[model samples]
Target: MNFGTKAVHAGVTPDPSTGAIMTPIYQTSTYVQESPAKHKGYAYARGANPTRNALQKSIAALEDGKFGICFSSGMGATDAVIKLLAPGDEVITSNDLYGGSYRMFRKIYEKFGIKFHFIDLTDVNNITPFLNEKTKLLWLETPSNPLMRITDIKALTTIAKKNNMLVAVDNTFASPYLQNPLALGADIVMHSVTKYLEWP
Candidate 1:
């Protein structure tokens, strides 16, 4: 099915017990088990919840990825990805990025020994000099916040791949509707669902 069809029906189906068409929110904290080793899918809310799983599965399907993990907030997701970089690993990122991301990378991650260098990603040439073995991640924020500057994802991905670096794109502005970074060769794509996906 196309993206539009998948968006509407990919992660949800009729409930087997009640025959409800919409995906019901599984709001409980825990699920009962027939035995200690054998269970009925869910164990705890923190690890997994039916509602959250639906959302995560939908997102992963939309992005054409194998897995999806939802977090309490966008920063939570960002922090999780950054954690993949060990202490003293370098990250090459855009100079004009979201303030929250900047704080996370510069203030928080730096304290943990993760170093970041912000450069003009629009001019792919400027980023080339910074690519090296130590660089673990290439963080891209296209159509950047406040400034709305667009970067060439394909070009950046090429550079990142050459150095065997992971490429993460902040897709909040353009969104999956306007942009799909994974199709353009990005390793990871993030969104601020609170903004366009959920806000009224």
Candidate 2:
């Protein structure tokens, strides 16, 4: 199906029990087990919930990716990605990243031996010198923070691919409607849905 049609019909269906036209929130903590090893799809709420799974599937479909993992907050998503880097791994990132992300990388992750070198990503040449075998990730935030500077996603992705580094973009500013980083060759794209997708 087309993008517009997929957006409307991708991750939702009428409620079977209530016959409602929207996906019902499954607000339970646990599901009944038919036997010790045999049971239904859901086991625990923390691991997965029907409503959250629907949203995850919807987002994965929208991004045209195979997997989508939802977290409690944007920071939670960032933390999950950072876990992929082992101790002593190095990351080359934009200096104009979100304040919270900068703090997390500089203060918290640094204690575990993950080194972050903040560079002016606007000058793509500056990033090339920093790439090495130990560089595990390249973090970007286009239209960065309060500056609103646009980095050429294609250019950066090319450099990252050449260096054998994983590229991650914080897409909160652009959202999926404006930009799809995965389609542009980024390994990961993140967003703070609380800022735009939620009701005030």
Best by TM-score: 1
Query: Mind giving the per-residue lDDT tens digits that candidate 1 earns over 73-189?
Result: 888989999999999799998889999999988888899999899998889899877767799899999999869999999988987898999999988888776788999999998
Pairs clashing in candidate 2?
none
lDDT of 2 by residue, 87-192 (tens): 9999998888899999999899999999999999898888888888999999889878878888888899999999899999888888776788999999898877
Best by lDDT: 1
The C-alpha stretches of model 1 lying farther than 4 A from their native spots are 197-200
Q: How many backbone clashes does candidate 1 have?
A: 0
What's the TM-score of every candidate structure? Answer: 0.94, 0.92
Candidate 1's TM-score reads 0.94
Native RMSD of candidate 2 (Å): 2.4
